[model samples]
Target: MGVYCSKKEVVEAQSSSFIYQRNRTTSLEEQIKARCPNSSANFEDENSHSTKHSSEGKMKCTKVCFICHERVRLDHSCTNQMVKDLEKHMDKDQLMDILMKIKQQVSKDEQSLVPYLHWGTNVALIFNPFTQGLQRTELARNIPEFSRTILARENRIFCIGGQDSSTMKSLPTIFEVDIEEHYRIKDKMNMNQARFHHTAVYDQKYDFIFVIGGMTSNSMGNQFKMLSSCEFYRVQQNEWSIMPNLKVARDTCAACLFDSQWVYVFGGRVQFEKRQLTNVIERAFFSRIDVSQWEEITLQGRQRIMPEFNVGMCHQVNDTELVIFGGKDTYNKQTREVLYFDTSSFSLIHRKSQAQSRKSSNVDEQLSQAKTLQKNYSTAQITVKDFRMPLEIEAPTSPFQIANNLFVLGWSKETNGIHLLRLSLINLNWKEELDFTSYLASDVD
Candidate 1:
């Protein structure tokens, strides 16, 4: 500058001087503390007075009302270090008004979200008949205890009451799996009783899972007994209540819901001290959420002995007929036969029919009433028919229906494998769907 340098040279000299100062080496920690003064307590106290006014300019805080549990945002600009000025300026009446508005807004938001939370899509566990295997679905993590019961409701499968794997005794543990969520297992409230080989049915109207008869051994394990007792699990409340005992104690019985008002239990073995097996069909009537009772119904005009001690598969064909398949006969030999029951016939025996009969008095009126009653009686007549399946299934499990196709899961002696048999509702023809040999092999390897 003293030599009268040009403006470009003067600028370059200043830039060089600044670069020399910045290039001087320093400790990493010292450099950090130098550049970030407020990051440490030493620099904080050093700059406290200088930065006091700037930091006190404005601060945002949250306030909550103890009376209504409502929260609101507040701001303060006072520089006084010793006092909270936001609460002092608040008016109780104004805050209460704001609280009411907030509550209304929250209620509206919840109303908008309710439908999506309550409405769930329908899902089913799909099995491919042609492939004879589950369709790329996740298997449940835990295997069921011996003689377990499986029930389906609202796209979730509830597995309840079975023999414990560790103790070889009955378990009260309840597990559920959501079919829509890759069959993920979830823990549920335990049942009041530990049991196995029980029957469970879902009541759609009341949203309850009725757990019926099952067997459990004594503490000594030397004697085995069947359970005539029954209980129901309330889905909404996650609670269980005792239902009226079955007319007869049963184990390994088939149960189904009829007309949404009755649970029909079929052919199960009753064990006495002498181990005698008795099979009977009973219907449980549901009148209210808290009350249900079972009554025996006669199977009229049947020639074949009712399958006793047989693990038969039962399915509701309609309001009128239910088809039962594959249980052992009284001879203790597995049979390849199908049985059909006319369920509507049982309604004719109800108290309503007796009331209708007592209402008619005059001869002409009685005659006309009899004619109409006869027509209704003819339609209500219970018919049981035994048909032979193409293949014999030993102790078939429950039958599941999709569309018009009826699928029965059972074991076949010819193939020596667990097979799924498909029966067409249209033609009543039987076809082999899947074998579990390959599925089991893959699981083992």
Candidate 2:
């Protein structure tokens, strides 16, 4: 008659057999290697000569361990003693309770919105709130090209025409990057004109990418030319078509689409028979088939001073609202001026408060200029406020919007490195996201 054994005894026996068999297999492998010193079997991982061995003396596959295959169980005596020791030393309620706490300690990282900065043709800096509870951190990833105007839609990033940083020559090539896949499809389509420092806006309703005023190189690629010509790419058709040109030729300007019907361009260095920073604003109507002529509009506010090239502006939380801030003024000095443009009040002039009107002695003179400008054209109201930015940030470039936050990339004199700054739309406060001083030091080393 056969005698039955307890579950613990059965587990212990299975574990012992597995250990003995594993040791014996290793010993046989060492013997085979000793015989063939220069053969491929001398290597560690490959099973180059294992297939030739008889099944009886075949080595155990290291990948097929006890944890993976349930055939080999844990030794009951050893595991039981470990549990007893842990309980006695720590005085825990239960082993599972401790494990659950550990698992809950570190939350899994779920990045809903990712903002990317072009570091170079081979690397990119990504802003994320990491798993370790850092509010916002910069992660460097080796990736594709450098682009001046980049527009994001869903999980894809479109890199439009821009001058090559290495050669400083304009490029017509377009690159589409799938951030999730960590890959880029280059030369998606070439633009009609090679340009850089341009403004691009993606129209989601019609799937068109509108490329606006930008700077291009001359025939010799030695001198720069400001462009007033505009064009757009039909994403669905994979083709480019010319659009109406801007009245004011400028580069490094701000452009935003309002109500999916109107495109507004404003605030940049302009050359209208003379080289000077411009406060001129222009708007045009864009449709599925055709775009109207660009018409100048008057921004109703105090005597406005335009920011230098590379002004940072973003469509605020409200679709009709825009926030423009952080650019060098006409004096070539960085300014903290922030303009809140409300397009919902289009064509309707906002009268100043009685107190403000009383305070301003030249209210009638300002009203007369506004009336003359608004007679035959549309008008938009803007309120200017001075907001403080960190001292290190200088030369802020065109900003892009992701949800309610606007991120600007600029140079930092204090740290002597690149700084990514984030401005909150709700509170209108700025904070430094990440500084690349340490990374720059390592590169120098």
Candidate 3:
């Protein structure tokens, strides 16, 4: 009884011992590293290594031009500039001679041309905004390949793999396009199923592109059905293989490969269920089954993170933050507010925008305004220089949609534009309201 200590005291003593042991462990690790410089495998971030290797491979495509199908001189390649120059002088009469020679020389090359970046906001008021600022642009082209499913590849930004509404089934064609240059489409791979509303994400660990549950049909259909299978596309082998079916049937699901080891699939519609939104997190590990095996995670925030989203589109800004933005809600109205999810707890971030009057038809008249006007308000002839609408954007891409940056508001009624509320995540500030609605009259319905 005299030697006995309460549970709290005992626990505190153990905690102190654990802290001492941890410090010693850290100290030993540093001393050993210094003593035997290259002995330890030294746990490395595999993602960094993979990224370096990927970058190295990228530099090897010496002769391919990612833009305009033009002949570009790579750093070390040898080409006769005189020959190219003289061709410019050759007249249309001799054009056929030049064409044949160029065609013959180029035919020997096997690599396909890279797509260039194309951007257009339909009308003058619209502007191409994403880093992969491409222009197959139409308001109606809302069902983009990249945005549709995991439609993006590693180097490539977005591709077309998800379903097409016209066919009324999942698409068999796999379109791969680089995100940097959003100009053209890549070689299409025929998949086992046409997937629309499926989840697509690149697994660097396995060097494979995996597609999760989506809708499919034998032929086109009037109404759609959910798919329960998972498939993988081998970029190197240029082949397709089917994997184990999902534990649950999902359509319009969102997928992300975070921690370089886990692919989380969540928030999908289950078959004909009207309000079926799942909070299940399917963890596909980087082990042998990176191509297939999945286990459901019963994490604390599964329900909160997934929410009860009906029409939700989410993109991972990074490992820590996954921004779930715009999608038609139960009411069919698009969203502007976003939920920022992390390891500890969820935090709410709000967005705002501001505009100031700068010019007026009559500057003198504006200055002549009543003295009672607030200094911030202005004088006669003063005008709102920038009509920046202070609004919130939900999902942010770059330029049009900054890559994993700003907010993406589907359609902000206030500005009547597809709003991208601008502000640094570090310092929340409103930039400008991007109005795509003006362009919608022609394309987006």
Candidate 4:
């Protein structure tokens, strides 16, 4: 009787295993039919359709379970038939809990994939001043308007605030170029006000571009008016905010960033009935990464007017000195005079001529002209002397400093082309860096 009981138990166990295997196979077949409705119609039809989709490169056999909504890739290697059986036994609450966990994991993964500004190997070498060579890459696109303000940050160049070609009016539109990515052009956020003849300076430490005084025609129908209000743009945030009003309304001024602490604006013109010019020097101080206040620097003794009408360039020579060049005087005459300002004393300390050469026979004549020029500003404390500039630099534009070298772009009257003039801070000598007329002409065409 004991032997008979043991044999009966073995037979019962084998039968139970066979029933479990049959149930699992049935559950898997049901799952496949539910997920792929086309397969429920006919197996041969489903196989042909899948073959056609695969030929078209559109076959996606993966399906989401109705119970848990989890995607499962279906293929011949699928050996987990028990998963379908287990899902059939699961309650709705258990399935919902599994889905919630899966959603949370997906959210975390997406958050971790947020892109950041890449800083490695993205520095652009547009032109080499020391080698007098260009990289031979085209601008991302044609500038929307002429006389726009250009500012550089990281591996990008931004062109902002110029006259619109269609309306012949000032534009607030901004454009950017990524130098590392084949110089791809992209439009960026617009400024609060449409401006032209404005100045832009980038702060590397904080990644801010401050747009200073310029002329805008928004208020007066066709006439451009000077603006004292300023604005700064945060690059990372892609937002713009108004800064404190400048101490004086100015336009067509020469501006420079000094020691990362102050932005000096010098020599701009205000037009009313007649054009009024100023030689005022004012500074906007950066406090806690934002412009806090502005202070006007008084020039002791006499005030010698600098340049106006977008004619001058300001290059910071050191922590305490700035060199200014090529601006129109009060007489509306373009002068090739170089002026040095002492920031410590807030004074114009030196004045010199920017002539390439002076013949021995013409020395007395040059001296006489220098004396005449000095007499025009007899009250100013300036030492007038003859200093030479490179012959290729003509109609000099604003000067920008990069890596201790000052660069000035201008048109060469002799070559009938555009030239880039570079001044090395170490040697304080000017040299022709590159000629960009042919390259620029091709782009314009």
**TM-scores, in order shown?**
0.57, 0.57, 0.48, 0.59
Q: What is the lDDT of residue 10 in candidate 3?
A: 23
Best model per lDDT? 4
Residues 35-150 of candidate 1: C-alpha lDDT, one tens digit per residue: 33122333224223222224321111112222333321112111121112322655334433544555444432211100000001122234543233463333545545443334
Q: Candidate 4: which stretches are off by over 4 Å?
A: 1-125, 135-141, 146-151, 219-221, 272-274, 301-310, 353-388, 391-398, 412-416, 443-445
Clashing pairs in 1: 132-434
Evaluation by lDDT, superior candidate among 1 and 4: 4
Among all windows of ten consecutive residues in candidate 1, which has the lowest summed lDDT?
111-120
Backbone steric clashes in candidate 2, count: 0
Q: Residue 358 error for model 3, in Å? A: 41
Per-candidate local distance difference test: 0.52, 0.52, 0.43, 0.54
Model 2 C-alpha lDDT per residue in residues 113-162, reported as the tens digit of each score: 33444445344444443221212222232222224535444534566777
Off by over 4 Å in 3: 1-158, 162-167, 177-186, 203-207, 273-275, 287-289, 301-306, 315-321, 328-333, 343-433, 437-445
Order the candidates by TM-score, highest first — what do you get? 4, 2, 1, 3
